[model samples]
Target: MPRQRKRACQDTPEPETEAPAGKLVKANKAEIPAEPLGEAKTSDSPEKNRATKESGNETSRYWLMKSEPESRLEKGIDVKFGIEDLKAQPRQTACWDGVRNYQARNFLRTMKLGEKAFFYHSNCKEPGIAGLVKIVKEAYPDHTQFEKDSPHYDPSSKKDNPKWSMENLILS
Candidate 1:
């Protein structure tokens, strides 16, 4: 008996007659409608729009911050104890930086001049609220991002148009 070779039609499965591209395919769930790219759809309801506007205008009435006592002690030693010692430390005057969360970013955006925040020390043996900080200036471009040697440098950020920033805060 001679060996036989299969024809292309015999080897391959026949292609099904199906709907063309862009046509809806039958599925278990209904297809989700996609919004146009780069543009957010606004609510048609007037009440929803009014509520959104009001919420955007609302100031962050309060906030809390944290620092470590051991880190503070490592930085410097002081004869005075308690809140006074913490207040006297140089780190107390340091700016709050490196916050990357979108919600935190939004809060930072909402922060206005003179807004007060409670400084709290965490991840330490004695974790608790430490002191008060006043927002001395509104949000501005963070200089750290521009430094090539800095850990915070972002290549995406430019000197003219910065994405990340810091706010001037003073101890009170």
Candidate 2:
């Protein structure tokens, strides 16, 4: 019988790191520059800033609120949850927090009192518009931003200059 030769793992070449066609490659340290303390800059151009301000000033802003039916439902048939709900009774309004996306944060900042928002259920079997809600108050600092124990807390966010904000909402 012929003896089998042993293969060395180190002798085999490693696979190339090329991405599939049309896919973007991840940026490395050389491609992405590190920000210095207090030197962070925004990429918003003058035109873009003007457009954002204009859009924010426009009345009748629309929004969508997502809630899990199983998590917030009182009765199986109850479609709307309000301040009267046991879980929501302590605070007439709940702080809408944990939004890390800057664009979504900007949207939250644009909410005004009496503004209408459609309540939608995402990641559900039947995801669609569930009900309607009204903005009871304008944007205010989300307290969760300051609590280090909270999952939403951001060390980069200062209490005096909180980056996360939310508004009081009520079922309509």
Candidate 3:
């Protein structure tokens, strides 16, 4: 069974703190609802509209993926990935990789194809949910783990038995 995160109470107010730029943190559990929550986007592209409509499935699970919008140095690698960066990718799809947290990686593994997730912009001056994305592919071995130059490299993770996994997501 997959591990579940602790849910925060809706009645309780959370204290706001000043977080440094490019830091990643778990989102508030209280804000996650059974149904999708966000402003409806109108688009000229039919493909974009289709993805948006297809995401409204009853079985589709929701997740919050915190990505740093501002650039910062981590293990000598510049970490400045954001929602706009995802949109600029080929077919607007990219691998959700470099997750080091054990529990967070497990959560990524549990994400099913077609499921929806909030592209949360964390550790910035105006941090918030930037956009939504749909899981285009299921969990697979994270290629970055095998790259010696990659910041997420894990020397112990052999090709035969990889230690890290990642999912492919498309802009929704």
TM-score to true structure, per model: 0.50, 0.52, 0.66
Which of 2 and 3 is the better model by TM-score?
3
Order the candidate numbers by lDDT, best to worst.
3, 2, 1
lDDT of 3 by residue, 83-160 (tens): 767665555566788888887888888887767788888778777777777777788888878878777789999999
Candidate 3 residue pairs that clash: none
Model 2 steric clash total: 0
Ten contiguous residues with the weakest lDDT in model 2: 31-40
Can you write out model 1's per-residue Cα lDDT over 90-172, one digit (the tens) per residue? 43344545454556655666676656665555555555555666665666666666756554557778899877756655556
- Per-residue lDDT of candidate 2, residues 71-144 (tens digit): 32212222333222313332223445456677667777877666666555554455555555566666777766
Error of 2 at 123 (Å): 1.7
* TM-score of candidate 2 on Cα atoms, chains taken together: 0.52
What is the overall TM-score of model 3 with all chains considered together?
0.66
Q: Best lDDT goes to which candidate?
A: 3
Computed on alpha carbons, the lDDT of every model, listed in order, comes to 0.46, 0.48, 0.66
